[model samples]
Target chain A: MTTETTDAELTIWRDGRFQADEWTRAAEDEAVADGPAILPLERFLAERDALVSRNAPLGVSVEPNEAIEELAPHLDRVALVTLNFPKYSDGRSSSSARLLRERYGYVGEIRAVGDVLIDQMPLMRRCGFDSFAVTNPVTRKQLAEGQWPDVPFYYQPTGSTQQAEVPAGTRPWARKPS
Target chain B: MYRYDEFDHGFVAARVDQFRDQVARRLTGELTEDQFKPLRLMNGVYLQLHAYMLRIAIPYGTLSSKQLRMLGHIARTYDRGYGHFTTRQNLQFNWPALKDIPAVLDDLAKVEMHALQTSGNCIRNVTTDHFAGAAADEITDPRPYAEILRQWSSIHPEFSFLPRKFKIAVTGAPKDRAAIQVHDIGLELKRGPDGGIGFAVYVGGGQGRTPMIAHKVRDYLAEEDLLAYVEAIMRVYNLHGRRDNKYKARIKILVHETGAEEITRQIEAEFVEVRKTELLRLPDSEIERITAYFAPPVLAEKPARSSAFEAAKADSAAFADFATYNVTPHKAAGYGVVTISLKPIGGIPGDATDVQMEAIADLADAYSQGEIRVSHEQNLVLPHVALDDMPALYAKLAEHGLATGNAGLVTDIIACPGLDYCALANARSIPLAQDLSNRFGSPERQKEIGELKIKISGCINACGHHHVGHIGLLGVDRRGEEVYQITLGGSGDETASVGTLVGPGFKTEEVVDAVETVVDTYLKLREGPDEPFLAAVRRLGQQPFKEALYGTA
Candidate 1:
């Protein structure tokens, strides 16, 4: 018996289907890509002045334990912030995402990477994550078909403009439609 | 009693469909078992020792006759012939197959019930006082707030993936029947100094490897800011709570390391910011809409004195004993709350057969205005049983072995589904409970023991709530053999305290006798019979009890 499976290829997705891969990842020793480069958080900090002066959209990939406070001041200069799950069970990144949006008022994109599961996407969206990096085959298809568990009613407000996408007809924190 | 509106129905139906597809993917090998574990757990399906376990939430312990009847149906059709009511006011079917859970959830949704967050790392089913709406001493019905929290926390986007499982309990009355002190968040409904609706908020309380009583973070939080305040607390825990060590990750530890005063400041700052947004502000109209569902039911007026009730008590000593122990004062005139004890001598503490469930549902419909409640004590309650109908209700309950007259007495033990069913348990709690039950089975012995709570857990995760039991029995595995540890002077009421550990552990064979010795010692040294076990323990301390147990000098 044969089965289809996802490859090591990673594609950025926003507004549902897979989008253009405009962002390139830069390692510490690697040279920056021409257009937009997502750097490790530590690398971004070390190269803060040079990276910021280049005028290309910059993103920083953050680990779970790293303090989001480090990126707080740099949020305006940064065009995108990438958070890792490492494993989906690790929830620290969700907090970081919320802090970026709710606390720091970061308007740039927040993307989820690594071990991203379909079950947790709606929640990730609410934590101010606007895009996801999809490599899981089943998740890729599920997202393409718009088949995530959609709970329209909400009892809390978040920094992201989520309800606007689905139009839940709810006031802030109002679960029941009035 | 809160009927699901169109929004509620749509949400649950969609969730059911979502889970059904998830299950299908798991079965077809499209999803790995590792991948499927959290999803299944989010839907309240546990991969237990023998078979899969499904926990169905009875929110705030309130159940309609129809909802309970559906549980019975799930028990018979999808599981074994029985279900176990848990310490968190939920029902667990121990033997449901993974393939059949979607069907079971479908049946539940038909009755406006679903096990949305009964497990996983999410905020669990919010529990409240069992006699929430009907207790005579209640200042306000807590079910409304519980229902509100239920809606707010259901698949909560930001807070579902917490550091650990979080629990919240609310109590309407100051008596604290829900054991608010041992939960992650405990809300006591109280009128503020100006007589406005508010909650005395307590945070960081939990019972696990480490038992801590929640500190009163805010003495008077306005009702409108309930969700905002809780959101602030959740955010703090979510961000700062230790995820490196799973064992020390609960909010209790955070409160311990950071100190209560410091944590309270952080929470207040977050609360101030969140409250300004008006995101989760509880409008009076929404509160009123939810509160209306829990309003006391209208009933035909009758005299306070029921001649038939009096006659039955006089005629049958069994009925008299039941009336004395199992019945409590209800808020409404001529009404009483009836506790149908699932704890019978030598039987499991909270197992109810499908037939018993169906019969209790019938009784609720006929006598309780179709209302039923599941207490955290593992007993079923008929919240609005009239005095005129008490005897009749008692008679029907007796037919199904449901009429045990030991609501809070020695025989009404609280035990976890230990080694018999749980993968985490070190010993068997149910058999030990049965042994104690048989030892103190008689009404004479139980009445003499009087208002004693004997809570047993097979392990320290404290699902059995041994930390707050009046006489707590904790089973520990000593070099691979089960030995029990004894703790004294614990209470779960308004004045909650963790039990102090006494000297030494007892062998499994001797543990029952050890408990008996403790009880006998209480009986011997009490100031008077009027002084209950807890009061005497508090006054005398564990010195006398310890000396009696180990014959220590």
Candidate 2:
């Protein structure tokens, strides 16, 4: 009934925080230390059960609303949710991550897993992502770009205002098509 | 024509230096392609199908002859002898190497020009009616306001990374020649009841996969609050716009999702909040100062008609045809705005050589008021040419291959640099365009056909704007062979609509014949010669053309 989460576990664990600068299988394996193993969307679909960890559940990341039904139920057992942004130009993953959180009610740690840029962090954060798995091995200077004076300045009454300091009482995402 | 003050010059110089450093870092491998891709695109450099393409901004389509010559110089020195004038009224050099782009930009900076925000997901170049000042029906020249917007939006700290690219167009005339309806943000300049100039803002209109006419956002936004209102709209789009779907990222999609009324309300609320501070409104004197930069040139008092021009028109049929087709009415009485058609019959639409560019610049200085407008339709405009100077101007233009005598005629078609240049194209568009122009080359025939626009885009990307042509030809590669698709009855005016596809695709060689058949069908079906193909299509749907096209197939 009680779930335990720690700050140190989520801060920076991928390849000891900054080991491999590329998307390698070995690097990804080492990165997932806590809840469950994070597999690419393609691998999970092929052999979902076999890839599961002995101690933790297996979590898969898929592109936008592709197979939400299959991935939603596994969220209860899975601990880490990593979405793959195949390319910066490709935005399908961003939508998929949002759907996983808001529509399917996924409570696990959601992360942006690939082709991440410093400027995109603000946008990624606003789209309901809590954790970011930096794949590019960005320097400290690049990471420092996370500071914007006042982001989420304009709040839409319709969608998620997770990045903004919206009041807890008012749920922006709750408003349906009126 | 907004003169770069110390602040403007300082800002642009700093931006150029930053880009130059970025380029140096990229070349030295300090920055990889992954890292430099966004940076390069933000500065309007794209690694297209073949080599790199550098898009230089022609702010509001207004430039002094000096700036125009600099573009010509860039073409001669850095690029393949010619430059392509794009629909966005910018000049793009196709062959500039990645390493040389910074130098090219530096050269442009020397002429007070840069390619900032010409591409990428940020706000792109602000475009306006080519005949902004010269149009007879204009309430107020929209270029001054457009220039102000250009300054405001250029490398703005916020709204740099929008969900998608945004395009804004302005028109001072009620005739709507700028295709304002199809732009992401369309502004129509008009004088209010108080005699103060304001803008009619249209939102969410764009011409791509999901083409929609932008709904009117405000009846009138005061001239002073223009920048603030624009900022408010940009803020709304940046925050609320769908980031997940690239296709649904444009403000048009948001306007569609939330009706125009709701979007307008949101924008108005934001504008009110932002305008409370003095951040967005330009002082009346500042607007006047900007407007003074584009003040009408000293025009001599001359007769509206010259007997010599009439004699030349009568004696030389070629000159007569040129005068009839190329000349447009000017706001000034004794002057006529001339469009030096770059779409010469059987030639590339926008490929003016270095010499041609120089000639155009010289002609602008000598005949016009020292200002030249690069029309979005890919033609050079002599804004305030005296009627008496027509013969001399015509002679000069003829010598430089600029006197095509076809402005809005079928031969003066708009065609993108298709497969020949662009990497994304499915088939060649320029060649097809040339062939069609050749087939309809005769001035007598072109004049007989009257105002007809034939736009050809190589692919569905619609860079060539084929979707909005009266007779739209889209080239697609089928089974490793070039195939041309025809669309009929598309227009980008106030009543903007994407052309509907008609019948199956045609082979590369048969395209000219297909266009001929369509034109002939229109000629036969038109109420009269006065009824243009577009108007005919609008009055009576595409059934006639569709039947004529596929009746024998």
Candidate 3:
């Protein structure tokens, strides 16, 4: 749950806890190498050939207002997509995550970054976000302790891997009358 | 009435526990007030003028006698011995401690009720025609579909943090008693050309500071695509709905700013993608399962002409008035729908004491097949009273001060909780409604006026739905004084229209006279008493009414 002190360094959280930091988020005009790197969508598009030739894990950071369809053709080459929430109230990224998983059929990890509050984690998880890059220490502690309030069952079916399958005989409304 | 299945029961119970933990966190100072406000609002708890107001949703206004009795119990145990029924077919307890909310929610959960999504930026409680199953003109019962929407929208992953609060209303009948045209999304059940049921979807309709009637987004959408289509609509709004301005953040503003044609285009595009997924599709079996819960109760047909009913009506003029004004024709042959008026002379429009609620519950159990409905007009309906038992029911209602015989009369006003209880109100709507009720309290005078709807709101938020009122009054604060602004020619039915403002506003003391002036003008302008006030206003524009209100032009 504790962060290493480094400027502009990114830590990846996967499967429930923080994993090792390996990918370096590339700055604009940074040279590509045969190593893990996360690039902005614009920079990724500019250096798509070099990144593809590198033959390593690649990720792209997407802005809230960016069209998700622009990354549809590149989904096969990317391993992760980071959806940025400028603020918690701006919900465009949630829709973007759904489009990526359900529409584009992208199987890579989708992480929510920036102002990632603990309360919205459940919702983010429901919308195909597998991980959250939380910046707040208290929220990070809560997430690590599994103390965030979570509702196990859901009313709507979201195409998320973490979604619990609605049990049979529970949805009696889906049964034929005798 | 739709009963809760095991899944529905478990879902509500889990929601209660989740909210209890959230409340505990707020109390322990783990969550700040800003963080706790949305959670509390989602659970229907509000910090009002004096104390916490807990709004309990009576879904689509349908309530079992047992549930009503529980509401009565809660009123007596945790709050003042009274509750106010709102225009949205919910009940609000105006006085409660914040610490008691979890217990209140727990009690409601025991009765298969919870306040989840009753407030919040998410989808709210889905409302439908109060007389859905009993109304003779209905094409099909709408409660099933409303219940479906309620389930789909509850804790929806993507739409929870919407631009603003969204409301959905459904109606199966063509007559539109549910005020479908003024909701964020209005669904009208219609029979397609192939004899299959579908919905005529309307989007972007709302009544607030800026009132706009919803436009038809889909002429005919298949029944199986209900959730998918709604999800498409929500997606479009969630992505592009304005967030910078709270006042202009409603879906109505979105639909208005983005041309309805363009919004429809985007929704259709979104629907193409959404309908392909199994995520939101309504399967035939699911529809059948939900529909089964709303199957109408069997009642043996009785003679159309009840000699006891006729004799009782002939014997008592008061009973005749109640039969004429308070009873509506039921779909069942020998039964009638009875509206028990909560608006007595000089009384608050929708407040009922614990005793009255308990009495109504008893009456519902005895005569109405244990079913009671809360109408948007702030009255309760006993949906299955036998014609032969009208006299006995009327007698009991009279004893409980519920038989006012003013169902559609001028005295049956729909008003909001203005400055009296609401924190957002600018003036007091209850006092104005009381004054108007007292002035038009005479039964004979009310009968003569005949079906003049006077809706008053204390602010521009339009919780009172003043824009659709036949004669609307809006309360505004002006330079430390409360002034009332009047609107004319509003109706909330099939031909829904926002009322037009009638010149300047009136001072508090002068507002009642101004209302009287408008009513007198309508009386003078009408061809006869048979033509109701709304019809007269529609036929003859607002010019004459304006002249009468502010003198000749």
DockQ of each: 0.49, 0.04, 0.51
**Candidate 1 lDDT by residue in tens digits, B1-553:** 7988777888898889889998998999988998899889999988878988999999999999998888888889988799999999999999998888899999999999998899988899999999998999999999999998988888877788889999999998999999998889999999999989999999999888899999999999999999999999998898889888889999999999999999999999989988887767888988898899888899778777788888989999889999999989988778889999999889999999999999999999999999999999999999888898988889889899999898999999999999999999998899999999999999888988899999999999989989999989998999999999998878888999999898899999999999999999999999888999999999999898889898867
Q: TM-score of the B chain in model 1?
A: 0.99
Worst ten in a row by lDDT for model 2 chain B: B151-160
Per-chain TM-score, chain A, candidate 2: 0.61
- Give the per-residue lDDT of model 2 (tens digit) for A10-89: 33323223332122232344454444455656555655565455575555665543555567666676665677666565
Q: Relative to the unseen true structure, what is the C-alpha lDDT of residue B50 in candidate 2, on a scale of 0 to 100?
A: 80
RMSD of each: 3.3, 9.8, 2.9
Which candidate number maximizes DockQ? 3
**Residues B281-309, candidate 3, lDDT per residue (tens digit)?**
77788889889988887776888778889
* Chain B only, TM-score of each candidate: 0.99, 0.97, 0.98
Would you give me the overall lDDT of model 1? 0.88
Question: Candidate 2 on B1-553: residue-level lDDT in tens?
Answer: 6776554565567667777877887899978897889888988998888899999899988878899899889888888889989888989899998878888888888888999898988778889999888888888888888887776666543456678999999999888878888888999988887988898999998876677778999988889888878878887786578877888888999999998889999999878866765545677877887799888777888777778778889988888878887888887777888888998889999878988988889988899877998888988888898888899999999998888888989988898889998888899998898888889998778887898899988887788888888888888989999999998888887677778888899999887898898888888888998899898888878777777777844
Q: What is the TM-score of each candidate against the true structure?
A: 0.95, 0.79, 0.96
Task: Between candidates 1 and 3, name the one with more favorable lDDT.
Answer: 1
Top model number, lDDT: 1
Per-residue C-alpha lDDT of model 3 across residues A42-156, encoded as one tens digit per residue: 8888778866668779999999778888999999999989999888777889999988988888888898999788777878887899877867776766766876565655677
